[model samples]
Target chain A: MPSEFTSTLNSSTLEAGQTQLKIDGLQLNFGGVAALYNISLEVKQSEILAIIGPNGAGKTSLLNCISGLYHPQRGKITYFNSSEHEMTHMKPHQIAQLGVARSFQNIELFRHMTVLDNLLSGCHIHMKTDLFSSMLYWGKAQREHIQFRRFVEDIIDLLEIEAIRYQTVGSLSYGLQKRVEMGRALAMRPSLLLLDEPMAGMNSEEKEDMARFVLDINEEHGVTIVLIEHDMGVVMDISDRIAVLNFGQKIGEGTPDEVRRNPVVIEAYLGEEHSPYPLRSKL
Target chain B: MISGIFHSTYEQDMALRHTHAQKIRLAILIVFLLVFPFLANRYYLTLANQIGIAVIGAIGLNILVGYTGQISLGQGGFMAVGAYTAGILTARMGMPWWASTLVACFVTAGVGAAFGLPSLRLKGLYLAIATLAAQEIILWVVTHWKAVTGGVDALVVPNPELFGIRMNTDFNFYWLVWALVILVTFASVNLFRTRFGRAFIAIRDQDIAASVMGVDLFKYKLLAFAISSFWVGLAGALTAHYRSIVTWERFTIDVSVLYLAMIIIGGLGKITGSYLGAIFMTLLPAVLSNLGRVVKGVFPGVEGIIPFIQQATFGLVIILFLILEPEGLNKIWKNIKDYFRLWPFSY
Candidate 1:
């Protein structure tokens, strides 16, 4: 079923194993409190780089800075698509136009619109018909609208959301809404996809489905992904590399196996298992 | 299940009128509109003209408030801009009616976009107040800018010459006005079907998500305002030409509230609501006055308070619609259609 969808994915313009995004000494503060402190990270092309951290570790904040939702007080975030694009100060829409798309931690599908319309909106930047042409609803406007509708239908098929394509997004279940959000992001034809806890609240079966979709998006779509996840099992299973943040700093960064073995990573999680305040006793 | 509706192609699926029944109904409507002038008397013709003008204005307001979810109290002010612009161009500067109306639309759209600047940082009730301020400011300019607006006295608008024929009678203006009403309605429907319309709705639904999904929030918000005001400005220009006068009193804060009531009662976010709302609101006063005349004939002493009763009834009806049917006339119309759609077999 998924083999046919290979044609739907844009042929990757990027060379394999190239640096896709580089974040340098990122500093973000809300008033006097620092959210992200000197976070430097690298995302290679078509890799699933999961950022795992405890609460308030600035994992989501890092993703937000890279996606242009938050401007870091000091740091440079550069995206490498066809060229090196300085994305530190770009607007969200401008960054999106350059093939960067993000799904919110909470599903942000247009509540009033149908599933299809929300996905169709993902094709907004690609569409070129002006107001007058749209008003006439013929020639360019009709062609573009139908073409994008076809594109959105392909995404709907890939996500296996055909049944709820016409359903209002607000009426959908949590898992379905999350899938729809991913489908909407995919509809943008993004080269870099930022997902904040894509499987935050879901059953094991739903979590497995989401993990599979995330892998499919990264591998099959040839898109670089920066994911923030709390589930250690899924993170270890699917992530190509893992970056761990604790207390607004990157505590450990390596391959999933390496990170799992690192004492620092284990301490951040289990917290000095044999020591006096072994994280469990503190909690 | 909806039976006998099938589409083999995307074009068919994306068509404005989907089913054969809808197309048939559209044909029937076109026939009715074409035959209306001949059947109706002069008084009804004038009334129809008024409804047509209101329909144009209400649809414009609905685009901003209903579809785009931007509450605006500047509809009346924008209309005044259109009316005054057209009045000055045609009556003061000797420009042709059509040309002046065209300029009026663009001018009003510019003003609307300018006022919409505050919307980028504002939301909901705060944004509504900002637009209300726009209404008051534009009205003040129109009233105090005496040399251009012709002081406190009403500016006289020339009867427009359409295709070399003087459009002085309600019979002549009715066709022109209704034709525009149809054109603007078609345009509004088309606007929503495309990406531009989707952008407007996206901003309304979720601004942050929309921006991240590549919708330029500031550009689209201003565009919504400009497009909305263009339709409204056209309505105002037509009103000026139809009535052969332009006055500050006609485009007051109360008039802005009245337009808001039209969209609220018509159903927000639906084009059908705009048409139904405009017709219902325009006809409401006329119906109440006729009822007033009948009551006066019966009592002979109730004439003095009839105006007050009319005002009170209009306010009460708006409140009733808000509380009882917030979705407006469009929902009721849909309910009627749905009930009959499945007939006796319906659950």
Candidate 2:
């Protein structure tokens, strides 16, 4: 089954020149304890890949490495954009500039700024107007500001966040704030979107809404998404392929059906005695 | 429709207006600035000069505390460095007044950066302590360095001349000071929209997040320090040249505290607040002095009570402003204008 998953992933690998992200021999350690061991992954153009793991399974660590928040001890993360440049060891903002954007596990919206301003800040890198032009409120600055505002307004509308557009993020509900964070990331107009626990701590309805939003973003926008989530049901339901990590090691990688029947994954999740889900329920 | 055009979030609403209304207002302000020297009598001209000097210093302090969110209790020190540098160059080296002023601003900015070095390692209370130490050290140096600073004795700065016009009259000096204040204020306002200005605000909001977002903290912080000191130094140079006198007593820790008070009483991080604060503080003493003269005529014992009452009132006002209206007089002005703007329908 693992071999079959590998073959599928291999087939998906960037037709020689179109891969969005490639990770090889990734490893991370906190002092003496290894947090990630030789984890490797690939995200091709416009693919939705899910990483599922239990608590302390090095899921966030991998995402951090990809986002340039943490440097992996031994790894090569090569990301190729449409510009024919492969980015390696770039800074977080530099990586962001190369069309990779991320939302945090805990939302990191600029709380002091209004929701509109937060979205506007995400477009800071894209703004063409200089400081002098902005200060003077010149023709170029006004035009550029209007353009960016239109773009941001479209995203806000798409996210269904128009009512609270002028409200501060600090005053928003947690679920709304999370959506705003997604909007902010989307404002960057990233080709590859990394959502860290996109549906974490949400109720069933909120999770369903978020799942629909993610699906719409992926299918309609054709954005390649790499997400870290704990909900196995959501992962199994949406992901084309899933990677399971246990104790800082990749225990299984396969389709949902293949992973469900794997004995090692069952043991890792339910322990030896309670391995079979149907049998345990009956007992 | 007017309010609709101006309607925005707190961030936008607080923005310095550059609209047609503001342009007309600015033109009127320019006219007022041009005519102020001729209209005011000698005492009023002297008062205007003091306001100009204070405004210059306040603008620099506002940049440090308001834009950068770095507490500096050492603006007085930077001012002293500028004053003494100008004083020594002109009085001893026979440097022209203008040349000395320019040299003084640069030298003092360099010294301000030296004082700003500890800010890289220290912040908040620790940063304030570093500045306080700078203030004390600078004052001690100016007092003890008899050769250059002339100790505590007043160093007579020569009467300045510009284009062969001797600035002997208060009106002439008033124009010079007013021009300097306006130029400095304009530059300071423009600085807010720059890369350095954004970085300063970023650091103020969240240093770690700012760094992660590609802002180089060290470079920007140091730049903020340098720019802040440069302005303060310029103010000092103007004061030294305008006064034609320099003494150690001029740049004491008290003056540093007073400058801090000005920024606080005006409003933190607002350019308009600085000007408002300077005018407010500079006029308070004159108002009290006039009141004192009236009371002296009415009550024989009121003469001794005036200084004590003034000092107590100053302290009480600062405390009141901090506790009751920490946003300072700027907010008050905004409220009044907003009330008028909204008129019958208050929001």
Best by TM-score: 1
Please provide, for model 1 over B1-347, each residue's C-alpha lDDT reduced to its tens digit, 9 standing for 90 to 100. Answer: 46656778989877878866678989999999999999999989989999999999999999999988889999999999999999889998999999999999999999999999998999899999999999999999998999899766899988899778988588888888998999999999999988888888998898899999999899999999999999999999998988889999999999899999999999998899998999999999999999999999899999999999999999999999999999999999999877877777776
| lDDT per residue (tens digit) for residues A82-115 in model 1 | 8899999999999999888889998888999999
Docking quality of model 2: it rates as incorrect
Clashing pairs in 2: B66-B269
State in Å the error of residue A31, model 2. Answer: 5.2
Task: Give residue B172's lDDT in candidate 2 (0 to 100).
Answer: 85
Top-scoring candidate (DockQ): 1
lDDT of 2 by residue, B49-143 (tens): 89888998998888888877789999888999999998889888889888998898888878988888888789998999999999999999999
lDDT of 1: 0.89
Give the runs in model 1 whose Cα sits over 4 Å from its true position.
A1-12, A270-283
Off by over 4 Å in 2: A1-39, A49-52, A55-58, A65-100, A115-117, A123-176, A183-193, A198-224, A230-283, B1-3, B6-31, B89-110, B140-154, B167-169, B296-299
The TM-score values for the models, in the order shown, are: 0.96, 0.79
Worst 10 residues of 1 chain B by lDDT: B1-10
